[model samples]
Target: MKLEAIPRLSLGYLPTPIEKMERLSAELGITLSVKRDDFTGFGGGGNKVRKLEYLMADAVAQGVKVLITTGGHQSNHARMTAAAARKYGMKPILVLRGNRPDLYQGNLLLDHLFGAEIDFLDPDAYFTEINPRMAHHAAEAEARDEKAYIIPLGGASALGAMGYVNAVKELSEQYAAAGTPAPRYLVAPVGSGGTLAGLHIGCSLYWPETEVVGIAVTGSAVPFSERIAVMANAGAELLDLEKRWTADDIRIENDYIGPGYSIPSDAGNAAIKLAGNREGMLLDPVYTGKAFAGIIGCVEKGSIEKGSSVLFIHCGGSPALFPYAGLLTSDLAG
Candidate 1:
C-alpha cells in the first residue's frame, strides 16, 4: 500500500524495538516477545504516538491551527496528544470522560502540564459523546478564523491505522534480522479498535500467515469485532487489494475485561506485578496489564498451543498508573 497519503505531525518514535522475553516465555510454556511501541520516541511514550504522527500531519496539511481530542480523565492517548500538540506549536483542547473532574491525577496531570484545555463529561455517558463535545469546542476556534481539527479518542481513523501497518512492516525486518520466524500470534488491548485493526490487516498483507489477537480493554467482543472488520477492510482497500475477511480471521477475548474500562482487575494487577517483578517491565492497569492478564489466562488454559511463539504489543499507558496507585500499593503491602 502507498504510505504517503497519510498525513504528518512528527509525533512518534519510529521503528520501536522488538525483544523476546526468555524468562516469561519459559514460565508460560510459550515463546513470548513484545514490540515496545511504548517508547515512541516522545514525551512519555505509547501507541498513540504512531496514530498522532499521521493524524496531526493531516491536520497541518489541512491548515489546522487547533487540534481537539478526547478520552477518559487519565487517558494516555489524550496526555500524549497534548504533549505532541505542544511540541509542534499547535493548540490542543481535550474533553475528558471521568467520574472525578476536580482531582487532577495520572494522565490528567500531564494534560494540565502540557497546557491542554479541559471539558468534562459524566462517567456513565455513552462512549460516543466525547467526539461531538470536542467538535463543538473546536467550532468556537473556527469562528475566530483559526482552523480546527478534531481527532477521535485513541485516534482510530483509517489513516492513523497506518502506523500499526508500518509496525508489522517493522516486525518483518526484526524477525528476519534475528533469524526467528515472524511471531505466530500478535496480541494487543483493544480500546478504540484502530491499533488492533491496523496490525491485523497489516499482518494479512505483509505476512498473511500470522494471527492477531485482540484483548478487549473496553467495550464488548461483538461491538469490538464489528468495528475491527470495518477498519481492516478500509486498510486493505487502501493497499489496493480486495481481501474478504471471515470470522475465523479475527480473535477477540472477553474473558478479562473485568469490571469496566480503566478500572483495575485482580488478574490484571497480578500480571502487572509478575511482569515488573520478573522482567522489570511496567504495564499500566488500563491497557497493557489487562492485556497481559488475558495472555496469562489463555496460556494457562491451554487455549494458545504450547511452543507457539506469541508477541504482545506493549502499547504504553504508564501515565495512567499513578491514578491507580491505590491498587498497586495495596497489592505491594499485602
Candidate 2:
C-alpha cells in the first residue's frame, strides 16, 4: 500500500517489547502476552507517541510553529503532545477540561515541566465551547506571525491513526520472528477511538484471523464502535487503501467503564493491583486498568476461549496513578 511513501517524524522507540505474562497467563488459563507501547520512550513514554510521530510530522510539514490540543486535566495524550511539541521546537497550548486543581500532579505536572501553555475550562464548556474555538485559537496565533496546528482530542485524526497501522505491522513481524502463533484476540483501551480504529484496520489487513476488542473507558459499545469504524475508514482513505470498516467490524465492551471517565472504579483498581502484583507491571486506573479488568471479565464470562492466546496492548499512563494515590490507596486498603 506504499505506506512508506507517507511522511512521518522519527519519534518513539519502535518495536517495543512483546513479553509473555507467565503468571497472568496461568491465572487466566490462557496464553497472555503484553504489547508494551508504554515503553515508547518519548516524553515519558505512552501510546500517544506513536500517533504524534505522524501527527507532528504533518504539523511540521505544514510549517506550523505552534500546536494546540485539548483533553482532560490528566490526559496522557495531552501530556505527550506537549513533550513532543517541545522536542520539535514548537510551542504547545493545551486547553484542558476542568478548573485548575488545587494541586498539580501526574500528567498535569508534566505538562508544566514541558512548558506547555495551559488554559482551563469546565468540562461541558470544553466540549461545547472550546472545541469549536480551536480554529479561532489557531487564527489568533497566525495574527501573531506564527503558524499554528490544531490536533484534535486524543490525536484521533486519520493521520494519527496511521501510527497504529504501522504498529500492527510491527507486531506481526514480532510474532513471526518469535515463532509464536498469531494471537486470536487483541485488546486495547479505547478513549478517543483512533487507536482501536487503527488496530482493527491493521489486524484485518495483516492478521485477518485476529479479532480486535476495545474496552471503552467512557461511553457505550455501539456508539463507540460506530466512532471507531468512521476513524478506520478515514484512516484507510488517508493511506490510499480501499478497506471499508463498519460498526459490525468493531467489538467493544462498554461494561468496564465503572462510574464514569477518570473516576477510579473498584474493578479497575483491582486490575491495576493484580497486574502490579502478578506481573510486576503497572496500569493506570483511567485506561489500562479498566481495559485489563475487561480482559479478566471476558475470560470469566467465557467470551475468550479457555486456551486462546490474547495480546493486550498496554497503552501506558502510569504517571496518572500518582495523582490518584488517595483513591487507589483507600480502595486497595482492607
Candidate 3:
C-alpha cells in the first residue's frame, strides 16, 4: 500500500520549511538546520496536525460524527484535534487530564474557541477514569445515532504515525533541493511516540544513514523506544511494507526531562530563551524547549560531533507558552 493510497484529510500546510539556524549552528559549532513542523497551519500549528490528518481521515471514512480524544490540559494535540474536527464538520470531545483552571489559557483557551466539548479530570484520575468515561461518552453518542471515533492521547496510533513517514519523504526532497547531504542526526521531542516511530521507519527506508534521536519529554515512565518500535512496525504494516523495527532501532535520551512531564526545567527555560533570542524562534517550555535543550546538551558533551550536520524537528507548542508566562518571564529577567 502506497502512502498516497491512504486516506488523509489535508489539514496542514505541507512541506513545512527547512531553514538553516545559522546563529544556533554557530553557537553549537555544527551545521544545524530546523524543520519547522511548527509552521503547519491550523489550530495554532504543531506536529500534531500531521497525525490528525491521517487519524481524522479514517474517522471521516468510517462515517464518524463525533471525534473523541485525550490529552493534558495544555495539550497541543487536543487543540489541533478540536480544530481539525470542526474543519471536517465533526464534533470534538476532549477528555483532558488536569483541573479546570479558573482562567483558561493557552491550548485550553483554543479548545474552547474551537467549541470542543471538554471534560477535565484530575491528574491521578486520568489513567483510571478517562478512558472509561470517553467510552461511555461515545456509547451515549452512538445511542443518539451519532458515531464517535476515539483517538488516543497524542494520536499515537499506527495510522497517525503515517503522517510523519510522509514527512520524512518530504524532508528528503527538501534536502535534495537545498543541495545538502542527509543529516547525520534528526532530533525530535517524543511525547507519546508516534512521531518518533514514524521518523525511525521513514529514516530507515528513505535515509538509512541518518540516526533519529528522540528526546523523551515524558521522562522514563513511558517506554518510548519500545512504543516507537511498536508504532513503527504497525505503521509499516499499514503501508504494506515488509520492514520491522525493534526497541534497539530507537535512540532516545531521557535524562533531560527536568522535573517531569509538563514541568519546566532550568535547561528547558534557558533553551527557550536561547532559541528566541538567537534564532527568533519560539519553543514551548513543555516540548520543544526540552528537546532543543537535549540537542544542546548533546553538542556540549560531544555526543554529536563537531561539524556534523543536524536537523532539529521543531514540533511547535508556542501557544502553551502563554500559560507559563510567570515562570518564563521571571527566569528570563533573572
lDDT of each: 0.83, 0.90, 0.91
| TM-score of candidate 3 to 2 decimals | 0.97
lDDT of 3 at 227: 80
- Model 1: per-residue Cα lDDT over 104-204, one tens digit each: 88788889999998787887673667667877888899999988888887888788788888788888888888888878888999888899888987897
Off by over 4 Å in 2: 220-222, 331-334
Report the backbone clash tally of model 2. Answer: 0
List the pairs of residues colliding in candidate 3: none
1 or 3: which has the higher TM-score?
3
lDDT tens per residue, model 2, 1-334: 4567788897899989998999999999999999999999999999999999889889988888989998888799999999999998999999988888899999999999999999898876766787666777888899999999999989997888888998999999999998987899999999899999889778877898999999999864349888889999988887787889888888889889999888878999999999999999999988999999999999999998899999999999999999989987884577
Clashing pairs in 1: 8-57, 9-57, 13-40
TM-score per model over all chains:
0.95, 0.97, 0.97
TM-score of 1: 0.95
Model 3 CA lDDT for position 9: 82
Candidate 3, residues 42-102, lDDT tens digits: the string is 8899999999988988898899999999988889999999998998899999999888899
Q: What's model 3's lDDT at 193?
A: 91
**How far does residue 314 in candidate 2 sit from its true spot (Å)?**
0.3
RMSD of each predicted structure:
1.8, 1.5, 1.2
lDDT of 1 at 145: 92
